[model samples]
Target chain A: MSAPGSALIEARGVSVRLDGRGILTGIDLDVRAGEILALVGPNGAGKSTLLSVLSGDASPNEGEVTLLGRPIGDYRALELARLRSVLTQANAVSFPFRVIEIVQMGRNPWMRGSTVDDDREAVIRAVEAADVEHLLGRRFTSLSGGEQARVSLARVLAQSTDIVFLDEPTAALDLRHQEEVMRVARGLAAQGRAVVVVVHDLSLAGAYADRIALLDSGRLDALGTPAEVMTAERVSRVYGLEVRIHRLGASGRPVVLPLRD
Target chain B: MSPRIRAVGLTLLLAGVVVGGIVLSAITGQLAITPTEVAGSLLRAVGLDTVWAPTDPIVESTLWFVRFPRILMGLLVGAALAVAGAVMQAIFGNPLAEPGVVGVSSGAALGAATAIVLGASVLGGAGIAVFAFLGALLATLLVYVVSRAGGRTEVVTLLLTGIAINAFAQAGIAFVLFVADTASREQIVFWQLGSIAGSLWSQVAIVAAVGVAGVIAAILLAQRLDLLALGERNARHLGVNVERLRLVSIVLVALLTGVAVAFTGIIAFVGLVVPHIIRMIIGPAHRGLIIASAVGGGALLVLADLLTRTMVAGAELPIGMLTSLIGGPFFFYLLWRQRRRSGGWA
Candidate 1:
């Protein structure tokens, strides 16, 4: 699909209007294989909206989305789902499912003709990949919010599709879980999966993202490598706060730290 | 717990209860028939002709026709309501939802009440069932419309609105009950308080058709429901048609509940209790939960009815009263346990 390693996701001038107001406007972006594209912006900057549209979850009012060179609307629901997996913002539900049951739901889109053995192997690997092996047998409801998020990541990983969208995956995570999640993200990209993530942590984005896409006021503020895009001026303008960009001694990549008033 | 253990455990429990309930129901009555006589009577009615000891029509009729059909109707309606409760709990993402919570049961009652008031039974065979189905379908639509005003419904909000609508429907029934004559009053009491007495084979077939259909449909939709339990926005992100699933489930619950109330009147407690027990045991996987709820409900209601009819010779207590006597405390127990487990006032 889409030349095997070429742009797997292409959005052409897409815009989204929620209720009666425009929330996202004229967004054009493409994601390719073995690439981690980080979407970063202030709250309500349509970062999540852009991600949702790109993942083919929500429909856009003004433009078209093509994944793997085919119109997204033309693909069957399970077909589209089999090609991509999404981990949304931190959310909770009332049902008290077990951790394994939660992970097994990931196999639904692909379990149409597969054997039971296939699904079991995928689930075990996914649980291990998310570093939730210790938490596998525990109750999902009894877990803390951060722990639940990790289990949810295990679920999405069990889905094991070629495209992944992570919306603020590390927003609620502790420092260790944050690194653990992004390491999984990077690993997926390394395996030729197109991974697009919306991360609030600028430093994490600097370290993990192949290219960063910055959104401001429903517009693309900047899109480039961490070295080219994450300037002190750009951070100050986008966030309306003073910021400092420091380069790591080993990698020479930008790391942002905010300077508060 | 492992899924296998849960499945086998529920199966054994439901089987023991069902067999015991059947035996108890078969023996309890004014007729004073032996277990052998009752079995022979049933077998002969099915054309065995082996029970040749002067098969008095009255005794035979009461045993083969009355008690058996009543038992079958109880099983059908109970299973329908209970499975509906399980699905509703999953769909609404609230543990408290059952057949009665979402106005489906009340709507069914209203339909039957309307049929009784209108003398639809005079039109013969299918009239009561038709009117009941219409009443249920309409009430479900109303609940859905009110819940959809802002384009989404919180589980709590939908449940509370269901309570309000149920209260309003009952008020209408009360209005009808107020102006009715004595014969109709007895009929209304029987219909309102819930009873399996006076059930016929014809009615059993009708309720079973709709109830079984609804339950099977619900079980089939369990996979999609897994995605739905992720909550609305995330469910949509996972490529599930959330609105369509909601509509289908609500309509199915309505139809099954409508047919159930049309025949069995208004049996309560089974729906809510059965699902709660299943969830408590299995930790809320809809696939197994729905099936377990159905089997458990069928067995429980049958057992409750068996006790109700046997409690007094020559007279039957209201089946609903018996269920409430047993189920009310059980309901409170669940609330207490859930509150304790949640470790808060929620």
Candidate 2:
């Protein structure tokens, strides 16, 4: 249902400079409605920096960022908060809060009334969608790391925003939860929302993302369909690792199978 | 115990303590009024009549003048300190955090001391309150800014900055004490020892008002505190205006700390000790911890003050001494308990 050529977000020549050093420079990117973009990069590739700018959590040193056709800075806090949500790689949570209670925090952007039924409904749906409904009543911090990740996923699912920014959202998860997160992000894209994820896992990104944007040394190395962008040559060049790209049957999606040296 | 059962048990015990503490505090004193007499006196004072007749004028005077204000101030101070303490802990993200432990109380005390010694008589009634508030605000802002100099402000950095500021401020106060005249010395002494002595009705009224406002604000912000418990980055991702939340909460806690320190002087430990106790009862959820600690802290302080007054005859010890006596051991006990549980403090 995505409108043809309707850009959900547009960043033009966006550059980020922090602490007397340039973290990202000469970056231009766009994502259309209903597309899942994987920001793939090695460490220190400015994937987090670019995600930070797009989610309105950080600003570009030069040029500009626009979300949903509006300048990032011009959007009111509530407006910006309502339109997008971010899930960073690491979270330091303390003490135990009921899973449902933790998930209800996603409603902070829209809650005007005290009645939390709608919020709870959203949480329930998110938890069910994330396959963590069994852990809804459990304490969040008490859960395993993988379980906490799923609960946090339920939280953003409850956020139910048009654009979701995930900065290495599955970095702490095991293999199964990593797949679950990719599946969820892809599902969100299928529902006509834009999902941008920063990932180190070449295989996961290749499997789920409609397009892969490879970042190297804070610059865009490649940005195109998974088939076009992900090749053994590019992977080895960017990540300094021997990697083979297996073109999976039918979908024509490139499955990255790294050839260890 | 499971979290749910522990929560329920703590809630009941805290309520019992508060109710029992308030009733006992209000009803008993050196004058030895019966429960009926206390009830009747309160009823008539508030324009509600029961079967009991009016007590003697002197006893009535005692009720209206001494006991009532004392109890109210205790409740205000305890509640204010606890709220401020909880906010500090949340902002600093350390369970050991306290309003005074971070220099907020002493800073307010220094401002109040300066106001009195300099006779900033123009401020008159509001003089001490304003000075205390300013001092607290300055200290809080200083700690926050100093800790942020390197583009990062974490819990450990903020706590250490607080320690450094507190040490420097105390050293300055000592210099002031060394150079002061007798009258100023006595006043500073009283302030340092922290007495609720000479708590006039108006003063009590101010403390109550500010304390209530502070506690209410904290309670309303309980959700943000909970989100914040997840840390700054996590909080921002959840749509919390991380900087704004930090700024507002720090300012609010400073205001409450200043007001509490202004009138009550440098009462210690209630803020730090009480909330930790409450968290042990209610678990770490700030939503429940803030409100429960407010009520529980208020009750504890009022009761402690009542003990301070009646603990000895013909002489009133500084309330600071009393709370320190209690808090110092409680602090050590927490250390010991933590040692036993985890083998060492983090």
Candidate 3:
């Protein structure tokens, strides 16, 4: 409804091939700042692959990607690192690093000649923002799945990048923690950064994303607001399951439920 | 304590221990020179006027020609192995990875074997050193190239590749020994067992130059290595050139490993254990880990060499055997404790 915000990232006719197998094909998308774009799809639908290409984690075999009007491949690693940060689904640290130490790693890009005082302050602020200050002294390997996820989020937040790509950041969290994580994403978007979240939960996507891009077999099946994309017919057709879209009266958010024959 | 202060303190402490180990190693032998006199002789030999110097020609020659070169070799080899281990662990993202265990040292051994048995020469005097470095770099590159898939390397792949390469290199060494004359065969066996017993000043000088350069390069790459531990995808996102980092790190690891192995033979556990011990004390920050591992490794080898020399009367143990005998148990302890704490392999 609001005029689309300025495009921060543009992918034109992008495709990815690995080991002679095509993983993503002809995906043209514009990710705009001040918006949360949720990529939702079934397993093996290439949502993660698309996110990787957008975040410069994987190079596309065909087509072009530009971030902030420059080809993604043209930017230096350090320069690109200052502009984007990615939170991968798996965060396994081999060493027993402290939680604060893990979060401090986020400041690595800015640590060139930066004082220790500045680093400590940035780490503390990121910890508070991610609400993981209580776990600061704890070893990362000692933390629970949810706690580690939050600490990892804090690490990404410490990067202070403009474009954030989070791949299933709430996959290990409880309902409350899930909401907390999604709230952080929304808050980041509100601060004028483009946030792309790859998630399996349609309800969370519906609640937080300004637009949902439904992917099926490496193609964009549908892309729009919840009401425009989450109709029972399209949901059933895309997911291959009968479903009902229930609208929450107060917030008018669509919730999808599978219907029995 | 602040990490900066802690790092500085740890560096100073390790430096003191290394110096102490060198002095202890220098004085305690069959001839039995006094520790204070040994120090004075060393300082005086280096043109520094000291309060005490060995007046006897035998003592002076013993200090400079015999003990000093061997001790210096031990120090350089120890430092090189440990620094290489730290860099390998960081690059491979595994605590257990090391040059000897991962076949890089054996690759160097094979190259050195070719030079010794086949009489290959590349740089006249530095022939063996050049071949060993080339062999080490090639072997590591082979393992890395084989393990990497889709722009990422898996630790399991690295372990597996290392095992295969190590076995292959062992067979190659065995073949070389089989083809050698009786005297050459004995020399090859002694070399394989790894001892600094016959260290020369020329050998010490070569290891020192190469080892110092490799160690310094590893230290400089420390920050990038820390970023790389975040996984390749995440590291790339954070503006690290993952491919470049991996390439440079492997080359440096090979250079360090090759130089140490060329001089000392296949000293296994120093590279594997020293870094792990330092990580336990100082945590896994490579910036500090690299420096501490260098000093700690040097001290450890000096101590090991001392053990080899003194543990038996008139007959010294092979340095490699002593390291493995000590390092194997220490590795198991670390593994068991880690399993108990994490309840899984990290």
Judging by DockQ against the true structure, name the best candidate. Answer: 3
Instruction: Give the winner by lDDT: 1 or 3.
Output: 3
Interface RMSD, one decimal, each candidate: 1.8, 2.1, 1.2
Q: Indicate the docking level reached by candidate 3.
A: medium
List where candidate 3 sits over 4 angstroms from the true fold: A1-4, A17-22, A113-121, A249-251, B1-5, B46-51, B120-125, B147-160, B181-183, B332-346
> Which pairs clash (backbone N, Cα, C closer than 3 Å) in model 2?
none
Q: Best candidate, lDDT-wise?
A: 3
Clash count, predicted structure 1:
0
TM-score of each: 0.93, 0.92, 0.93
List-wise, what DockQ does each model earn?
A: 0.61, 0.51, 0.68
lDDT of 3 by residue, B4-58 (tens): 6677788899899989888888889999899878878878878997778878889
DockQ, candidate 3, comes to 0.68
Could you list the CA RMSD of all candidates, in the order they appear?
Answer: 2.7, 3.0, 2.8
Q: What is the interface RMSD of candidate 2, in Å?
A: 2.1
In the range A126-228, model 2's lDDT, one tens digit per residue, is 8887888788777786788778777777777888788888878788788888888898898888888889999888888988998899999989999999999
Least accurate stretch of 10 residues (summed lDDT) in model 1 chain A?
Answer: A1-10
lDDT of 1 at B4: 59
Candidate 1 ranges with C-alpha deviation above 4 Å: A1-5, A249-251, B45-58, B145-159, B178-186, B312-314, B329-346
lDDT, candidate 3, A1-261, per-residue tens: 123488989999998888988788889998888899999988998999999899876789999999988999888888888888899988877567778888988988887867888888878877987889889888898888889999999999998888889999989999998998899999888888889999988988988889999998888888898778788898888889899889887767888888976
* Candidate models: Cα lDDT each: 0.80, 0.79, 0.85
The clash numbers for all candidates, in the given order, read 0, 0, 1
Query: Which 10-residue span in candidate 3 chain B carries the lowest summed lDDT?
Result: B118-127
